[model samples]
Target: MSDLVSVAAIKDLLTECPICIEHFDDATRIPRRMPCCVQSICQPCLESYSGGAATLSCPMCRRRHNLPGGVKSLPKETVILKTLDYLKIQKGLHLPCTDCPDKEIAVAQCDNCGTFLCSICLSAHKRNTVSKTHTINTFDEMKGRPLQSFRRLHQCSQHQQPVQFYCYTCDKVVCVSCTVVDHKEGKGHNVVSVNEAHQGKAKSINDVLGKIEEKTKRLSETESALQKKIENIKLSMKVARDDINKIFDNLKDRLNQRRTILLSDVEGKSAENLKVTEEALDSTRLLLTKVKSSSEYMRQMRNKADKVEDLQVMGSSKASLNSMLKESPQEIPFDRTGVSFVQANVQHLQNTINVAGMVRSVTFSPTERPNGIPDTAVHNVITLEPAEFPTD
Candidate 1:
């Protein structure tokens, strides 16, 4: 019995949902199905295997099964299926028609089962019967090709025929039929042959192209100059960073040396003050003990009465002791003046590149006569001798 129980436990551990074949984490709430004759499967995989059909057939039992309908029976599942249907529609997933290879049949999907059906087969599905009036666009319309405009110079918009002439005054293309109709109607329009108008427009377009090419050359030169200026700015920044770093290193070393000297001076002054205070405290303690002993001696000699003279000596000793106790200890004033270094205010030099100034005057005059011949005929000639300046 124990061996059989162990075997069953091992089998349970290895069991997988037939749909996913990955271990099942839980069976409740999460879409899990126990087939009528087979093991369990996740609901999603089962639905996918059934081709989103209204009726599902179990692979194990070979028995057909109908899915639940309406929001009341399966609200959550129906919502999920409808979402999938919406995505499928957006993706334009179409199945080719079996009857006609070229023609594709549009499917009307059921929101509940995610089932897609052609117009003919949709009549058989009870759930899809209500969706008969749903709008559907054909495959051709879904492609959405741009509309072709008949606005050419020699093309007619009305009859889509070749126009023989251009009505320059009206700026319209017209055929012989339109000229007779439009001209007879007293439209007061000017007309020219299509060939003549085309030639005139061609020459104008070629001249504009030539001007554009010339401007493009100037633009290329300007772009090259701008790029060179940017490179110069980058190089200047690199040099500035390097120079500033060197200055900071030098300043830091000088400050550190000053700090060390100041710290040593402060320590020496503090130690001297501490030693003097200790010596003063020891002297005060010795004086206090001597005075305490003298009081006992004065009491012992009171019978002799000659001790009254010694009272004057004790008074002088008391005065000396009081003076010593009242003395102030000398404190060394610490010098903190040279402890820190003041940083110099370093200013960055502004680098600039001024473009060359323009020429003040550029006079353009013809060097040749009106007949396109060089003007070599001199009108007047002047001969000058040496001139002298007056000496002061």
Candidate 2:
């Protein structure tokens, strides 16, 4: 039973607090006991430690516990017994400093004094007036030697302090000190958490990039369609031009043939009229010559008096010559029955030909009556709102 008690006492002494890396001595010193009872720490260390309430765990036993409120009473005898048991167990244990040449050093830290010292240093440290009230213990008395305490490390580039927040606009991590001094006063920058800023910007960029890609695709398709339409129009225009030129050439040839025939007919009629006038003038000259020759023959036969009948014949011939000289030339009328050189329908044909190259309107007949209404009953009236149809 004594051996078992000793072993139990030795195991209890091995437990230590995870926070300050120190053994629990007096109950007054360690106000908080972990749920496992293996780990305990002084009230001052528990209060000043930054590990909030969530992560209150023992380093040695890896057990979690809650802290006691206010001051509590503890048995003085129990405290003394636990301390004596711890001292005895520590006698066999040895700790060494990593930087020492002898490879043998005491692993004791003073809680009040905030100094790490060996047994010899502890004795001398106790003698000092400033460190006399400090609690001392070996490194092995502590639960975990190397405690991992996370601290804010990155400093704001502007303020030179640990960064705690993020600036979305500038895309940088900033500190609280920076927010007040540099950001608030200097640039009035907006700040947020680093993680939030990154996520928001990623979403925004993705949305915009998606729209850009869609627009680019639509533009490419539109360009291709427009190019095809332009080529079709060009081809259509060329065909229309060829058709118009062919129609004009045929009309021009017909017009020229008609003009030539009309001119030839006019020339022939004029020449015939001139020939008739010349023949009428020649007959009048012949009658006058006959009358003059008869008069001359009557004068020569003056000795044969009382030739009245012969003289009367010469006078009648003279009268005939004078009447023929006074008569006008006969006007001949040319036959113009089949001489329509300018067709009456030519103007209408030319107007139709001129419309060949134009953009003609196409009308579509409805296959079914709109809304199943008869065309005669349906009125094509449109109503518009005041805003939509503005008055001039």
Candidate 3:
């Protein structure tokens, strides 16, 4: 037993339940299967979230399933049960006492009783008086232990004898007395040694290990790919953010240029209009002074001169005043225009903003995407150009 119980063998036997993180065994690692996902879920986890009004969701896929019949109705995963059994047998390789619940490792196996015993139990068994001829072998004696002999140590419940022969037809091990009775040769029973039967079980376990290894390799590859994908997505997001920011920055510069141009035009037009109005006012003042002088002269000279002299001065004043009045009408001339924003014809912007004027739709995909939408659906396109605005 000491030779069989190597460091590697003990390491291989110490496995934990995926859900509970306890030793994977018949008691704790009870497996249940979801009908929709068909994947094994540990019973402890199932019970924790089962039978509530909320539907139980698959931990792997997150797809919800109804357990109308409750948690007990979930199907048992037979494969997982077999897996646990294989693990239990591997554990027994490091022989443990049969009678105690404390998991004390046994030092020897009783050949006559077919049971592994601890130091205390072995001494007690040797002292017992049922004709103490029982042969005992220490773990050090069995340097090359046979793997199949572990399960052969159990006694048959009916005969109280060590189980030795495995009945192929019944698919179970039986005592010598059972061979004569229930497992009779007349019934064509193919009873073989415990070694052969257990060897077959070992082969089956190896097959399961092979499949698990294959899946583990695939899972590792997928994990690597997913991580790379996430990194690439983050890079893409950063690039898009920087590019969009740059585009918007340029748009702001163009807007500033437009504003400057519009304001300069208004200033130039106002300055030109101011000059025209000042010249018109100056011409009217000069004409008004001349008219006053002509009228005063006519009044002062009326008493001393004849009608011809007064009429000549009045005619010249009338001509000058008429010219000034004609020029005044032109000052009220109105053809000045003001500037405002106009809507662009771009469809995306037109659909969004109410006002229309150079509606620069900087089209971009969402930085934070909604669930279920793939990265392939994302797109970013920006266009900038000035559009004519309707004036009020």
Candidate 4:
């Protein structure tokens, strides 16, 4: 009896449904136990949460429970209802008599008949010859006492006698006569008192609860660590991307500068070569003019002038020819010049460009790593150098 009263105190500690945060009762707010996860939820809350689905998942544990017959198929938490009844009785709330059509408040309960009684019924029961021997206990006596002190034993379905023992093989409660006939000691059935079975199951439940708590804690920590690793991976990618951009940008700037310099050199060389060619052409043309005029004068003097005078003119023309000849047009002041582009180490430079920057992995031993470095941490390196181009 004291044990039942102590167990009833659990209602004050945890009476609310986890989903709706409402207290449970035997009526509309009845508690229903989930077979999958063994969590108790109120009937209305469970129904609404199911949302007409054939499978219902427990709100607390997320374990699925099949609803072949809907929410009604889930077992009711009778122990919780019993505790609620005890609380109501302690508070002096009215409970209806089982036999009263008007629903009169029960003043007492019959232990033998398992019926709540009004004042009038209690007197009539004592006067009845057949039921006068029935054990009767008043509710007033149960105000501060345990409800179990006046509770009736459960009747067996087949024998109609009070069940006294539990059959481990059948997982059922049976009366003494049924235990001897059906759940015998020499048979495969393991029989024990109701109290022993209760203690064993209670211990098993506590052990499982402790393990579940530890597993949940570990999983939460692992999830947080995984999230951090994902963030780190994104950060690493960004850093590598920036490095690649920087390297290519530097290479591009250097290439552009080289192009500009090469173009300028080509232009300057072309201008110098053109000036040399133009001077050579001017010198050769002047020499040609002198030679032509000197030759023509010599020919006219020889053909038309009188003997001695023509001979004198011939000497002067000869002198002019000698002077032109000394100018040597064959040896004109011209230098051979041209512009062309030649690429050096074409294959080698192409190969270098192909592998200029690469993504590489580097590992470090525990001792080689700096302090505070994670074991799973990865590093990235981007390397590039200016190519050495040959001068043209």
| Candidate 3: Cα lDDT at 7 | 18
Please give the ranking of all candidate structures by lDDT, highest first, separated by commas.
4, 3, 2, 1
Tens digits of per-residue lDDT, candidate 3, 88-159, equal 444445556874676587877677765767888888888889626788877676444543232233557799
lDDT of 2 at 49: 49
Task: Give the Cα lDDT of each candidate.
Answer: 0.36, 0.39, 0.47, 0.54
Q: Rank the candidates by TM-score, best first.
A: 4, 3, 1, 2
Judged by TM-score relative to the true structure, which candidate is superior, 3 or 4?
4
Per-residue lDDT of 321-354 in model 4, one digit per residue for the tens? 4333344332212212233333433235444443
* Predictions: Cα RMSD each: 47.7, 57.8, 42.8, 46.2
RMSD over all Cα atoms, model 2: 57.8
Candidate 1 whole-model C-alpha lDDT, 0 to 1: 0.36
TM-score of each: 0.26, 0.25, 0.37, 0.48
Model 3 alpha-carbon drift over 4 Å, by segment:
1-18, 21-111, 114-131, 137-152, 168-170, 177-190, 253-392
Q: Local error of candidate 1 at 101, Å?
A: 20
Of 3 and 4, the candidate ranking higher by lDDT? 4
Give residue 248's error in model 1 in angstroms. Answer: 2.1
Model 2: per-residue lDDT, tens digit, 1-392? 11111112222233343345465554334534323221234555654542555344443222344544321221122222233333533454544432235555656666544344666776777898877776765556654322211011244457666565666455455778867765673576888755555456545433433443444344344444434433443443444345434444566544454334334543453344335434443433333332232223223222121122112222223333333234333222221111111223335655533222222211111234468686786333332112211122
User: What TM-score does candidate 2 reach?
Assistant: 0.25
Give the top-scoring candidate (TM-score): 4
